[model samples]
Target chain A: MDKKRKYPYFIENPLEHDRVRRFLDIFSAILETSNYRYILDLYSRVTMKCSRCASECQIYQATNDPKDIPCHRTSILLKIYKRHFTLGGWLKAKFTGGSGLTEKDIDEMLESYWNCTGCGRCVLYCPLGIDHRIILRLGRYILSEMGIVPKNLLVSTREQLQGETHNSSKVPLKALQNTVEFLEEEIEEIKGVKVKYPIDVYDAEYIFFTPVSDYLVEPDTLMGIACVLHEANISWTIGGTNCDGVNYGLFYSDSILGDVNRSLISELRRLRAKKILIGECGHAYRAIKDFLPTYNDGEKIEVVSIMELTLQLIEEGKIQLDKNVIKEKITYHDPCNIVRQNRGIEEPRKIIRSFINDFVELKSHGQYGLCCGGGGGTVAVDETNPYRMNVAGKMKAEEIKASGADIIITPCANCKKQIGELIQFNKLPMRHAGLHDLIFEAIIMKDGKKHGTDD
Target chain B: MAQMIDFFMKPFFIFSVSVMILGLLRLFIKTIIEIRRVIKTAGDKDFKYTKIFMATLSWIIPGKNTVNTAVVYSIVSFVFHIGLILVPVFLMEHIIIWKGAFGFGWPALGKQAADVLTVITILSGIILLGYRLFSKQRRKLSSVHDYLFLILILVIFISGYFLPKTYSPFNVQVNMLIHIVCGNLILIILPFTRLAHCILYPLLRLASAVAWHFPPNAGKELNKLLYGEENKKI
Candidate 1:
């Protein structure tokens, strides 16, 4: 294939082209100024070459390509940073091989930045203790300003910023009321308890928030949280208008990330709940748990992961689990956002352990857990880069095969869909379940009734 | 003879005094402040132990590159730095002045140990430079500054070795003048280059040690912080 034609493969839409142009313009301005020179000087003086960092890169090991090395990525950006930005680089550009940035440099950057998972695994391994994740994030920030982000990600983020929901399946005020009514009926039939799936309940002790995807695609997980909360007689209510827990701006851009977080924070504060319970979504949890703390400027608020809260209730004997609800041998896949990035390693495992008798841990658990391939909005971009879902899913498939478990229990929705598709595509004889599905199944009724099989 | 002694001793005494003052400033004042900043921010508890272990092992062992590459470079950097130090302080002529000034005297390692150590350190420095070129990983990450640093060290080491053992051609005065000027230039450049890592490493380790033990916030406080209790969406 011709190299010019190869460039088209990366640019899927005109918006991307425009965004790239905008980014180049801004960078061009920076390059023409003394500020750029100062930045280059600081960066050059601070950045160092370390030989011990070679073994730590996962992308390098996976691809066996030297270009995939974490330091190589830094070098690419650093070279551009030096060339147009420094006096030495300017002088050497004439004699040395240091050519300044062109349109091609931006294209290469777009491809490179998107490939990084921002896992911080390399940061852990770097002997110099450099945070390469910061470099990737800075690249993303520049890309965002250029408006060259992936289209599907951009649309969803725009929707989230406007409607407070990424999915069109959002439960608006009436739908939310109807769903609560429907859930109440289901609760009466199953648990034989009269519980209110209260909406906009003032002075509630807890405001239970979940992704809109849960209301449409996986109601069982949402219902599971409700059933557990109802059984424990905890005072909780779902938000009436902004029921979705997702923050799409976390992926699309950085400039809007603060605003996206502020919008979410405003909704949470409006509810006046003593505590906020985030549902079993990986990226959502990360946005709230990790990113929010950095952007929110030390704002004090109570945000607890649903898995953590469930484990707490089980440990306190506030809720009892009937083990027979899940009789199959189960293995847990730690979502990358929760386990590796946010250090939420044990909470999900504790919840799974409490309910499942035949639980087996995957070989690469906790900090070393592989990504579900659908993370960072890759799963949402079905129309573009569809192969990323499967290509990245390869490691996950191998991990599951090695576990020898019949069922895979993970806490994140994206992981569920990604792993579920992998199972279907590979024809693996294993089913996937959300952690809440098992938890809800194991919840004993108020009248002492147990559901599922008696093994 | 008196004129020659005065000419040699004046510059030697000035440069040596300057170096000693700078070393004292780095060791006593600047190092303490940097260490304090590192300790204040480090989240890990084991960082203190790791920092000491890595620093000590850097000199004792040969190729164990841990958190700080500067430590390894500094060890082999002895050729350039020690030659720079001793050529001013403990040279046969300078020792005579120290005895005159302080009324103190001691056994010096003499020229043999000095020459041997200088050769060993210089060879090690060259090996490190060569390693950067041959190692694909290092070469890819290396900047112009890195290459420049390696060349600078090579110049200092090679020139010092070739300069007259006693008095010789190339005008000992001119050679000594070049050595003093270049040595001072490197001293000024040290704090700004990757050489700054030598000062930053201990502090980084201390910070890492202290950062490890930070408490996991209670879910209640975290929940409020993450999703404000007032607005109910996220």
Candidate 2:
């Protein structure tokens, strides 16, 4: 029998002190006086009672504790703001429930803030219309500055930043080159084409950034991009360095998280792509769609999600998709980061509908979509805490079962992995497919012949 | 009679009115300035319409929704506000006083309608207060200050409804005076409490609309800023 597993609560870990300190330092630096004041003012004005916000919070509902409410989490940061900044706080801190900050406060803040996946469901329901998730991010930023980040996540983020890829596999240039060569050969053998996987092509109109999974386990998704780009006859190239777009740094704090994005942006400028297309990764899309604009100082390079681009190509008659390419009855899982956080519900559906004839919809598809439970770098850590993962994935698993679709197609790499694990754990019949795989299968070649074989 | 008249003629009344007007004017100016800032920051053209529509609707909608579920409470609250406005300005007694003070006399709604509105407003206010205590979601969000304000409103509304007639041994004139004073106090506190949402809601909606449109991204050199480093990687 498999050994009983323990939940990997960061507080319970032996290396908690070192991890906590590092997180605290990073968090403090980011929440310097100016940023703190600005965030405090935003939080102050955003406090309002809305039942809609309460209705949307799954964690709060699951726990049945108002403390678990997103607004209550916001209140933790708001209390600090009250104590340090607000005038009302100066007059009656006790009455307002504001008090002197302590180490215990820091510990609780770390635990609660990290618990949130930053899915942004509350932003949809806020009546006064606050992005509670952004406030939580600010809390994460402060925590990260203090060196209080969770160990497993922090280690992965450090590796990704240092190695330029999240996987311990540490895909180097040689591996990447070999993988591309292998993909090219596979396509030639499978689809009868000698198409090139251009590396560092100068001044391409599009610079495609994808998660490392596509290069390793899911070559078909990359080939799908290749097939679509070929059919559209679009000028695009992949970067030789920092080719992986998935940014785990975003899960930690903005400053650390921002480096990967900044690098991607700077690379896009050098290549001079009219548009930068992000691959089928949820957090990568969220970073680009939501966070990138905030940091952007006036750079206007169009950054489009691959699903969005696929839809655009279909609309412009650049690619004709064969519906029968994916014969299995399929349902789409809208990754929380992409759907709720980025508000990218329609484009992916359009792409799916265009490519597959029997595409079914999950009940919680758009703003209400369940998290794959592996977001915010949960998938990367060893599955030491299986119960947390299972409990988190409960909603998603139930929805998948209810859908009765033979295949679950998610445009996000993280979602694909999480759902795959969930399916395996539950002994479900559903198999997982990336959105790009279907797109690849359906693409008609330049010679008016379908690229992918039925097998 | 002479002493009572002197009490009625005290400068406190004039001071209160002046202060209220000043506060209203200050709030109006501040609201306008903030709205302009939002409009200026709005990046997209679509936000312009959204801001305008939200600002307009905030004033038009009264009592959270049109069909008030808490009927008695809604009636009481609505009446209290209408009475607070009408009894001070349009009632024959106030009109005479106003004409003496400012040489202006305006058309007034009939006493029956005025009475009905006042009762409805006061009743609604009370029901809402009760709802706040009983409702789970509302109770969760409510702080002590929220409960205090609700009780305060309940007192003012209930007192205004029963003054000089049902429960008070005080003279009708004295009771009415007490009701007016307490009602005004509530108004003064309105700006500081959750009641301030009335004024802040439209402004916030406008800001959201503008922020949504102008999204710090439109028309700027996003490509250059985003892709500058990517070229090196390429």
Q: A1-455 in candidate 2: lDDT tens per residue?
A: 32332223552233334443444344343333222444345446446553445555766655566666787788777776666556776667757665456656666776677666667766655645566766676776666544455666665556556655533347877788899999888776666666778888878988888887678878878888877777687888887766767776566554444556667777777776667789888888876665564445544557788888888889998888877677889998888887763367888888888767887898877866777767666666554337435555766788899999999988888888778888998889979888888777777675643544443
Best by DockQ: 2
lDDT of 1 by residue, A74-142 (tens): 666667766765676788897877657766777777766766555555654454455565556556655
What's the DockQ of model 1? 0.13
- Reference contacts preserved by each model: 0.13, 0.10
Would you list the C-alpha lDDT of every candidate in the order shown? 0.61, 0.63
Candidate 1 lDDT, tens digit per residue, B23-139?
A: 545643554564454334322222336554564445434444432334554455444455545544555544665666556756665777666755765677677777678877677
Tell me the DockQ of each model, to 2 decimals.
Answer: 0.13, 0.16
